[model samples]
Target: MVKYPNGTFAAFRKSVGEPTFKKNQKSNYYRKNINFSDRGMTLEQMINESNKFYRLKEIAVVHKKPTPIQIVKVDYPKRSRAVIKEAYFRQESTTDYNGVYNGYYLDFEAKETKNKTSFPLKNFHEHQIVHLTECLKQKGICFTIIGFTSLNRYFVTPANVIAKAWWTQNKSSVTLTEIEEWSVEIKSGFQPTLPYLEAVDYFIADRKSKNGKYKI
Candidate 1:
Protein backbone atom coordinates (compact mmCIF):
# COMPACT_ATOMS: atom_id res chain seq x y z
CA MET A 1 0.00 0.00 0.00
CA VAL A 2 1.19 3.52 -0.79
CA LYS A 3 2.04 5.42 2.35
CA TYR A 4 2.16 9.18 2.72
CA PRO A 5 5.29 10.80 4.04
CA ASN A 6 3.28 11.48 7.19
CA GLY A 7 2.99 7.67 7.61
CA THR A 8 -0.69 7.59 6.77
CA PHE A 9 -2.01 4.81 4.49
CA ALA A 10 -2.82 6.48 1.16
CA ALA A 11 -3.90 3.75 -1.21
CA PHE A 12 -7.29 2.87 0.22
CA ARG A 13 -8.71 6.35 -0.26
CA LYS A 14 -10.86 6.63 -3.41
CA SER A 15 -10.52 10.36 -3.89
CA VAL A 16 -7.31 12.20 -4.54
CA GLY A 17 -5.47 13.35 -1.44
CA GLU A 18 -4.39 16.85 -0.54
CA PRO A 19 -2.32 18.55 -3.25
CA THR A 20 -4.26 16.44 -5.71
CA PHE A 21 -3.14 18.47 -8.74
CA LYS A 22 0.23 20.08 -9.24
CA LYS A 23 0.33 23.79 -8.37
CA ASN A 24 1.82 24.65 -11.79
CA GLN A 25 -0.52 22.51 -13.84
CA LYS A 26 -2.26 24.06 -16.89
CA SER A 27 -5.25 25.42 -14.99
CA ASN A 28 -6.07 28.28 -17.34
CA TYR A 29 -6.20 25.99 -20.37
CA TYR A 30 -8.74 23.80 -18.66
CA ARG A 31 -10.73 26.83 -17.55
CA LYS A 32 -10.97 28.03 -21.13
CA ASN A 33 -11.57 24.69 -22.79
CA ILE A 34 -13.15 22.29 -20.36
CA ASN A 35 -16.79 22.52 -19.39
CA PHE A 36 -17.32 22.82 -15.62
CA SER A 37 -13.58 22.61 -15.11
CA ASP A 38 -11.85 23.90 -11.96
CA ARG A 39 -8.46 23.17 -13.41
CA GLY A 40 -5.92 25.97 -13.54
CA MET A 41 -7.37 28.67 -11.33
CA THR A 42 -8.99 27.91 -8.02
CA LEU A 43 -12.56 29.08 -7.40
CA GLU A 44 -11.18 32.07 -5.50
CA GLN A 45 -9.01 33.04 -8.47
CA MET A 46 -11.90 32.78 -10.91
CA ILE A 47 -14.11 35.00 -8.78
CA ASN A 48 -11.36 37.56 -8.30
CA GLU A 49 -10.68 37.71 -12.03
CA SER A 50 -14.38 38.03 -12.81
CA ASN A 51 -14.71 40.79 -10.23
CA LYS A 52 -11.78 42.58 -11.80
CA PHE A 53 -13.45 42.35 -15.19
CA TYR A 54 -16.65 43.66 -13.73
CA ARG A 55 -14.93 46.57 -12.06
CA LEU A 56 -13.08 47.44 -15.26
CA LYS A 57 -16.30 47.54 -17.25
CA GLU A 58 -18.20 49.43 -14.55
CA ILE A 59 -20.39 46.38 -14.18
CA ALA A 60 -20.13 45.75 -10.44
CA VAL A 61 -17.73 45.80 -7.52
CA VAL A 62 -16.68 42.58 -5.85
CA HIS A 63 -13.61 41.21 -4.09
CA LYS A 64 -12.44 38.14 -2.23
CA LYS A 65 -11.98 38.44 1.50
CA PRO A 66 -8.29 38.05 2.16
CA THR A 67 -7.46 34.80 3.89
CA PRO A 68 -6.26 35.70 7.32
CA ILE A 69 -2.77 34.40 8.01
CA GLN A 70 -1.34 33.75 11.46
CA ILE A 71 2.34 34.19 10.79
CA VAL A 72 4.28 32.07 13.22
CA LYS A 73 7.67 32.64 11.65
CA VAL A 74 9.29 34.74 8.92
CA ASP A 75 12.65 34.58 7.14
CA TYR A 76 14.20 37.94 6.43
CA PRO A 77 16.81 37.75 3.69
CA LYS A 78 19.40 40.47 3.21
CA ARG A 79 18.71 41.03 -0.49
CA SER A 80 15.20 39.76 -1.02
CA ARG A 81 11.65 39.95 0.27
CA ALA A 82 10.85 38.31 3.57
CA VAL A 83 9.28 34.91 3.14
CA ILE A 84 6.65 33.42 5.36
CA LYS A 85 8.57 30.65 7.11
CA GLU A 86 5.74 29.24 9.15
CA ALA A 87 2.07 30.00 9.40
CA TYR A 88 -1.21 28.44 10.32
CA PHE A 89 -4.44 28.64 8.36
CA ARG A 90 -6.51 31.09 10.33
CA GLN A 91 -10.21 30.53 10.72
CA GLU A 92 -12.14 32.64 8.23
CA SER A 93 -14.39 35.22 9.85
CA THR A 94 -16.61 35.85 6.82
CA THR A 95 -17.71 34.49 3.47
CA ASP A 96 -15.31 34.05 0.57
CA TYR A 97 -16.30 37.18 -1.33
CA ASN A 98 -18.63 40.17 -1.14
CA GLY A 99 -19.29 43.42 -2.97
CA VAL A 100 -21.96 45.65 -4.40
CA TYR A 101 -23.65 45.56 -7.79
CA ASN A 102 -26.32 48.02 -8.89
CA GLY A 103 -27.06 48.96 -5.32
CA TYR A 104 -27.33 45.35 -4.19
CA TYR A 105 -25.08 43.88 -1.55
CA LEU A 106 -23.75 40.69 -3.11
CA ASP A 107 -22.25 37.87 -1.09
CA PHE A 108 -21.25 34.41 -2.19
CA GLU A 109 -19.03 31.37 -1.89
CA ALA A 110 -17.18 29.53 -4.64
CA LYS A 111 -16.75 25.78 -4.29
CA GLU A 112 -15.51 22.95 -6.49
CA THR A 113 -16.17 19.22 -6.22
CA LYS A 114 -14.78 16.23 -8.07
CA ASN A 115 -17.96 14.29 -7.52
CA LYS A 116 -19.73 13.32 -10.73
CA THR A 117 -23.13 13.36 -9.09
CA SER A 118 -23.93 15.50 -6.03
CA PHE A 119 -21.71 17.76 -3.98
CA PRO A 120 -21.25 16.55 -0.42
CA LEU A 121 -22.62 18.51 2.54
CA LYS A 122 -19.22 18.28 4.14
CA ASN A 123 -17.98 20.92 1.71
CA PHE A 124 -19.92 23.62 3.61
CA HIS A 125 -19.62 24.51 7.25
CA GLU A 126 -22.15 25.65 9.84
CA HIS A 127 -20.56 29.07 10.15
CA GLN A 128 -21.02 29.71 6.47
CA ILE A 129 -24.67 28.73 6.72
CA VAL A 130 -25.19 31.11 9.62
CA HIS A 131 -23.45 33.90 7.76
CA LEU A 132 -25.56 33.37 4.66
CA THR A 133 -28.72 33.27 6.70
CA GLU A 134 -27.86 36.62 8.21
CA CYS A 135 -27.11 38.07 4.79
CA LEU A 136 -30.46 36.86 3.48
CA LYS A 137 -32.32 38.36 6.42
CA GLN A 138 -30.75 41.68 5.54
CA LYS A 139 -31.84 41.30 1.88
CA GLY A 140 -28.41 40.76 0.45
CA ILE A 141 -28.00 38.94 -2.86
CA CYS A 142 -26.41 35.75 -1.57
CA PHE A 143 -25.54 32.68 -3.60
CA THR A 144 -22.90 30.09 -4.41
CA ILE A 145 -21.03 28.90 -7.48
CA ILE A 146 -20.67 25.13 -7.48
CA GLY A 147 -18.23 23.46 -9.84
CA PHE A 148 -18.78 19.84 -10.77
CA THR A 149 -15.41 18.67 -12.02
CA SER A 150 -16.19 15.25 -13.45
CA LEU A 151 -19.26 16.34 -15.38
CA ASN A 152 -17.75 19.73 -16.32
CA ARG A 153 -20.77 21.68 -15.13
CA TYR A 154 -20.91 24.91 -13.15
CA PHE A 155 -24.04 26.16 -11.45
CA VAL A 156 -25.33 29.06 -9.38
CA THR A 157 -27.43 27.70 -6.55
CA PRO A 158 -29.12 30.42 -4.50
CA ALA A 159 -28.44 30.64 -0.79
CA ASN A 160 -32.07 30.14 0.24
CA VAL A 161 -32.34 26.89 -1.68
CA ILE A 162 -29.02 25.73 -0.34
CA ALA A 163 -29.92 26.62 3.24
CA LYS A 164 -33.14 24.62 3.06
CA ALA A 165 -31.37 21.66 1.49
CA TRP A 166 -28.54 21.90 3.95
CA TRP A 167 -30.94 21.85 6.88
CA THR A 168 -32.84 18.89 5.46
CA GLN A 169 -29.60 17.07 4.68
CA ASN A 170 -28.72 17.15 8.37
CA LYS A 171 -30.63 13.89 8.41
CA SER A 172 -29.20 12.69 5.06
CA SER A 173 -26.70 13.80 2.45
CA VAL A 174 -27.95 15.64 -0.63
CA THR A 175 -27.93 13.76 -3.90
CA LEU A 176 -26.29 14.83 -7.14
CA THR A 177 -29.57 14.45 -8.99
CA GLU A 178 -31.11 17.00 -6.65
CA ILE A 179 -28.44 19.62 -7.42
CA GLU A 180 -28.97 19.12 -11.16
CA GLU A 181 -32.64 19.80 -10.65
CA TRP A 182 -32.30 22.93 -8.51
CA SER A 183 -29.17 24.63 -9.80
CA VAL A 184 -29.03 27.26 -12.53
CA GLU A 185 -26.50 25.82 -14.96
CA ILE A 186 -23.96 28.34 -16.19
CA LYS A 187 -22.54 28.41 -19.70
CA SER A 188 -19.10 29.96 -19.92
CA GLY A 189 -18.62 32.69 -22.50
CA PHE A 190 -15.82 34.93 -23.75
CA GLN A 191 -16.47 38.20 -21.91
CA PRO A 192 -17.23 37.76 -18.20
CA THR A 193 -17.53 34.07 -19.05
CA LEU A 194 -19.70 32.92 -16.17
CA PRO A 195 -22.30 35.72 -16.53
CA TYR A 196 -23.62 34.75 -13.11
CA LEU A 197 -25.29 38.12 -12.55
CA GLU A 198 -27.88 37.17 -15.16
CA ALA A 199 -28.89 34.25 -13.01
CA VAL A 200 -29.14 36.63 -10.08
CA ASP A 201 -31.48 38.77 -12.10
CA TYR A 202 -33.75 35.80 -12.70
CA PHE A 203 -33.74 34.89 -9.06
CA ILE A 204 -34.58 38.44 -8.05
CA ALA A 205 -37.43 38.53 -10.55
CA ASP A 206 -38.88 35.30 -9.23
CA ARG A 207 -38.75 36.47 -5.65
CA LYS A 208 -40.29 39.86 -6.42
CA SER A 209 -43.13 38.23 -8.32
CA LYS A 210 -43.80 35.80 -5.53
CA ASN A 211 -43.98 38.65 -3.02
CA GLY A 212 -46.27 40.74 -5.26
CA LYS A 213 -43.60 43.41 -5.46
CA TYR A 214 -42.82 42.87 -9.14
CA LYS A 215 -41.94 45.93 -11.16
CA ILE A 216 -41.08 46.15 -14.84
Candidate 2:
Protein backbone atom coordinates (compact mmCIF):
# COMPACT_ATOMS: atom_id res chain seq x y z
CA MET A 1 0.00 0.00 0.00
CA VAL A 2 1.18 3.51 -0.83
CA LYS A 3 -0.01 6.93 0.33
CA TYR A 4 0.24 10.35 -1.28
CA PRO A 5 2.49 13.12 0.08
CA ASN A 6 -0.57 14.59 1.78
CA GLY A 7 -0.72 11.49 4.09
CA THR A 8 -3.84 10.15 2.41
CA PHE A 9 -4.42 6.71 0.72
CA ALA A 10 -7.18 8.18 -1.46
CA ALA A 11 -4.86 9.04 -4.35
CA PHE A 12 -3.12 5.63 -4.25
CA ARG A 13 -6.36 3.67 -4.13
CA LYS A 14 -7.79 5.65 -7.02
CA SER A 15 -4.68 5.13 -9.11
CA VAL A 16 -4.20 1.39 -8.45
CA GLY A 17 -7.77 0.32 -7.67
CA GLU A 18 -8.50 -2.16 -4.87
CA PRO A 19 -5.90 -4.84 -4.16
CA THR A 20 -7.60 -8.15 -5.05
CA PHE A 21 -4.83 -10.61 -4.11
CA LYS A 22 -6.02 -13.20 -1.48
CA LYS A 23 -3.82 -14.25 1.39
CA ASN A 24 -0.85 -16.52 0.35
CA GLN A 25 -1.28 -15.40 -3.26
CA LYS A 26 1.56 -13.73 -5.13
CA SER A 27 0.90 -10.31 -6.58
CA ASN A 28 3.06 -8.61 -9.14
CA TYR A 29 2.68 -4.93 -9.94
CA TYR A 30 3.64 -3.50 -13.28
CA ARG A 31 6.64 -1.23 -13.25
CA LYS A 32 5.59 2.32 -14.04
CA ASN A 33 9.04 3.80 -14.61
CA ILE A 34 12.25 2.65 -16.22
CA ASN A 35 15.60 4.41 -16.39
CA PHE A 36 17.69 4.16 -19.56
CA SER A 37 20.28 6.84 -18.94
CA ASP A 38 23.06 4.27 -18.37
CA ARG A 39 21.84 1.70 -20.86
CA GLY A 40 23.74 2.81 -23.96
CA MET A 41 24.87 -0.09 -26.16
CA THR A 42 28.51 -0.84 -26.92
CA LEU A 43 30.12 -0.26 -30.33
CA GLU A 44 29.90 -3.93 -31.34
CA GLN A 45 26.25 -4.06 -30.31
CA MET A 46 25.43 -1.01 -32.42
CA ILE A 47 27.16 -2.58 -35.41
CA ASN A 48 25.24 -5.83 -34.94
CA GLU A 49 21.93 -3.94 -34.89
CA SER A 50 22.93 -2.13 -38.08
CA ASN A 51 23.77 -5.43 -39.73
CA LYS A 52 20.38 -6.83 -38.77
CA PHE A 53 18.64 -3.80 -40.30
CA TYR A 54 20.69 -4.13 -43.47
CA ARG A 55 19.73 -7.78 -43.86
CA LEU A 56 16.06 -7.04 -43.19
CA LYS A 57 16.01 -4.30 -45.83
CA GLU A 58 18.04 -6.35 -48.35
CA ILE A 59 20.61 -3.56 -48.32
CA ALA A 60 23.65 -5.65 -47.38
CA VAL A 61 24.93 -8.91 -45.90
CA VAL A 62 27.13 -8.55 -42.86
CA HIS A 63 27.90 -10.63 -39.78
CA LYS A 64 30.19 -10.60 -36.82
CA LYS A 65 32.79 -13.37 -36.93
CA PRO A 66 32.48 -15.79 -34.08
CA THR A 67 35.73 -16.54 -32.32
CA PRO A 68 36.60 -20.19 -32.00
CA ILE A 69 37.14 -21.37 -28.47
CA GLN A 70 38.05 -24.66 -26.84
CA ILE A 71 35.91 -25.43 -23.84
CA VAL A 72 38.16 -27.09 -21.32
CA LYS A 73 35.93 -27.23 -18.28
CA VAL A 74 32.20 -27.50 -17.68
CA ASP A 75 30.21 -27.63 -14.46
CA TYR A 76 26.77 -29.15 -14.04
CA PRO A 77 25.11 -27.11 -11.35
CA LYS A 78 21.90 -29.08 -11.71
CA ARG A 79 20.57 -31.99 -13.73
CA SER A 80 19.19 -29.70 -16.40
CA ARG A 81 21.75 -26.94 -16.17
CA ALA A 82 25.38 -26.81 -17.30
CA VAL A 83 27.96 -24.02 -17.27
CA ILE A 84 31.24 -23.51 -19.11
CA LYS A 85 33.81 -22.85 -16.46
CA GLU A 86 36.98 -22.60 -18.56
CA ALA A 87 37.61 -21.88 -22.20
CA TYR A 88 40.44 -20.76 -24.44
CA PHE A 89 40.71 -19.32 -27.90
CA ARG A 90 41.46 -22.04 -30.40
CA GLN A 91 43.32 -19.66 -32.66
CA GLU A 92 43.89 -15.98 -33.28
CA SER A 93 40.89 -14.46 -35.02
CA THR A 94 41.31 -12.35 -38.13
CA THR A 95 38.76 -9.57 -37.74
CA ASP A 96 35.49 -8.74 -36.07
CA TYR A 97 33.21 -8.91 -39.10
CA ASN A 98 32.96 -9.88 -42.76
CA GLY A 99 30.35 -9.62 -45.51
CA VAL A 100 29.60 -8.69 -49.09
CA TYR A 101 28.34 -5.24 -49.95
CA ASN A 102 27.69 -4.05 -53.51
CA GLY A 103 29.53 -7.10 -54.92
CA TYR A 104 32.57 -6.13 -52.89
CA TYR A 105 33.98 -8.31 -50.15
CA LEU A 106 33.96 -6.34 -46.93
CA ASP A 107 36.21 -7.36 -44.04
CA PHE A 108 36.84 -5.16 -41.08
CA GLU A 109 37.41 -4.87 -37.38
CA ALA A 110 35.21 -3.03 -34.89
CA LYS A 111 37.00 -1.31 -32.04
CA GLU A 112 36.11 1.14 -29.32
CA THR A 113 38.43 3.30 -27.24
CA LYS A 114 37.72 5.45 -24.24
CA ASN A 115 40.56 7.84 -24.98
CA LYS A 116 39.50 11.22 -26.26
CA THR A 117 42.68 12.29 -28.06
CA SER A 118 43.98 9.15 -29.77
CA PHE A 119 43.42 5.43 -30.31
CA PRO A 120 46.06 3.20 -28.84
CA LEU A 121 47.89 0.86 -31.21
CA LYS A 122 47.90 -1.84 -28.55
CA ASN A 123 44.21 -2.43 -29.21
CA PHE A 124 45.18 -4.28 -32.41
CA HIS A 125 46.99 -7.60 -32.47
CA GLU A 126 49.85 -8.45 -34.84
CA HIS A 127 47.99 -11.33 -36.50
CA GLN A 128 44.97 -9.12 -37.05
CA ILE A 129 47.16 -6.52 -38.72
CA VAL A 130 48.59 -9.15 -41.01
CA HIS A 131 45.11 -10.40 -41.82
CA LEU A 132 43.96 -6.92 -42.81
CA THR A 133 46.97 -6.47 -45.04
CA GLU A 134 46.34 -9.80 -46.74
CA CYS A 135 42.70 -8.97 -47.29
CA LEU A 136 43.69 -5.70 -48.91
CA LYS A 137 46.00 -7.65 -51.23
CA GLN A 138 43.01 -9.69 -52.45
CA LYS A 139 41.20 -6.46 -53.44
CA GLY A 140 38.77 -6.80 -50.53
CA ILE A 141 37.24 -3.69 -49.01
CA CYS A 142 39.16 -3.90 -45.77
CA PHE A 143 38.99 -1.28 -43.07
CA THR A 144 38.36 -0.65 -39.41
CA ILE A 145 35.29 0.75 -37.72
CA ILE A 146 36.75 2.83 -34.91
CA GLY A 147 34.57 4.29 -32.22
CA PHE A 148 35.69 6.91 -29.75
CA THR A 149 33.36 6.20 -26.86
CA SER A 150 34.37 9.31 -25.00
CA LEU A 151 33.46 11.57 -27.92
CA ASN A 152 30.62 9.38 -29.29
CA ARG A 153 32.23 9.52 -32.72
CA TYR A 154 32.87 6.82 -35.31
CA PHE A 155 35.05 6.48 -38.42
CA VAL A 156 35.82 3.95 -41.15
CA THR A 157 39.55 4.05 -41.76
CA PRO A 158 41.08 2.16 -44.65
CA ALA A 159 43.37 -0.76 -43.92
CA ASN A 160 46.19 0.70 -45.96
CA VAL A 161 46.25 3.81 -43.84
CA ILE A 162 46.35 1.65 -40.74
CA ALA A 163 49.11 -0.53 -42.14
CA LYS A 164 51.18 2.49 -43.12
CA ALA A 165 50.86 3.98 -39.68
CA TRP A 166 51.59 0.70 -37.95
CA TRP A 167 54.87 0.36 -39.77
CA THR A 168 56.10 3.94 -40.15
CA GLN A 169 54.79 5.93 -37.24
CA ASN A 170 56.90 6.19 -34.12
CA LYS A 171 53.95 7.14 -31.99
CA SER A 172 52.18 4.41 -30.05
CA SER A 173 48.73 5.67 -31.03
CA VAL A 174 46.79 7.17 -33.90
CA THR A 175 45.73 10.73 -33.28
CA LEU A 176 42.21 11.94 -33.90
CA THR A 177 43.54 14.53 -36.34
CA GLU A 178 45.11 11.78 -38.46
CA ILE A 179 41.93 9.73 -38.41
CA GLU A 180 39.86 12.75 -39.47
CA GLU A 181 42.17 13.18 -42.47
CA TRP A 182 42.24 9.56 -43.66
CA SER A 183 38.90 8.12 -42.66
CA VAL A 184 35.25 8.66 -43.51
CA GLU A 185 33.06 9.77 -40.61
CA ILE A 186 29.93 7.72 -39.89
CA LYS A 187 26.77 9.31 -38.59
CA SER A 188 24.43 7.66 -36.10
CA GLY A 189 20.89 7.07 -37.28
CA PHE A 190 17.63 5.61 -35.97
CA GLN A 191 17.05 2.93 -38.58
CA PRO A 192 20.46 1.26 -38.41
CA THR A 193 22.06 3.05 -35.44
CA LEU A 194 25.54 3.13 -37.05
CA PRO A 195 25.19 3.83 -40.77
CA TYR A 196 28.65 2.59 -41.79
CA LEU A 197 27.78 1.30 -45.27
CA GLU A 198 27.57 4.94 -46.34
CA ALA A 199 31.20 5.29 -45.39
CA VAL A 200 32.03 2.16 -47.38
CA ASP A 201 30.25 3.67 -50.38
CA TYR A 202 32.23 6.86 -49.92
CA PHE A 203 35.46 4.87 -49.98
CA ILE A 204 34.40 3.03 -53.14
CA ALA A 205 33.56 6.27 -54.92
CA ASP A 206 36.75 7.97 -53.76
CA ARG A 207 38.91 5.05 -54.87
CA LYS A 208 37.22 4.87 -58.28
CA SER A 209 37.73 8.58 -58.84
CA LYS A 210 41.40 8.32 -57.96
CA ASN A 211 42.43 5.11 -59.75
CA GLY A 212 39.39 3.98 -61.75
CA LYS A 213 39.19 0.97 -59.45
CA TYR A 214 37.55 0.04 -56.17
CA LYS A 215 40.70 -1.29 -54.55
CA ILE A 216 40.05 0.10 -51.10
Q: Write the per-residue lDDT of candidate 1 for residues 1-216, one digit (tens) a residue.
A: 111122222232232111111111111212356432344665556667678888999999988888666777888885578877777656645578899888888899888888786787777776677778778778888888887766666777767656666666243445666655555667554556566776667656656774421111
After superposition, the stretches of candidate 2 with alpha carbons farther than 4 Å from their true spots are 1-39, 211-215
Worst 10 residues of 1 by lDDT: 18-27
lDDT of 2 by residue, 44-146 (tens): 8889988999999999999999977777788999989988887777776789999999899999999889999998888877667778877877888999989
TM-score of each: 0.73, 0.78
Show pairs that collide, candidate 2: none
Q: State in Å the error of residue 21, model 1.
A: 37
User: lDDT of all the models against the reference?
Assistant: 0.64, 0.72
Give the per-residue Cα lDDT of candidate 2 at 123: 87
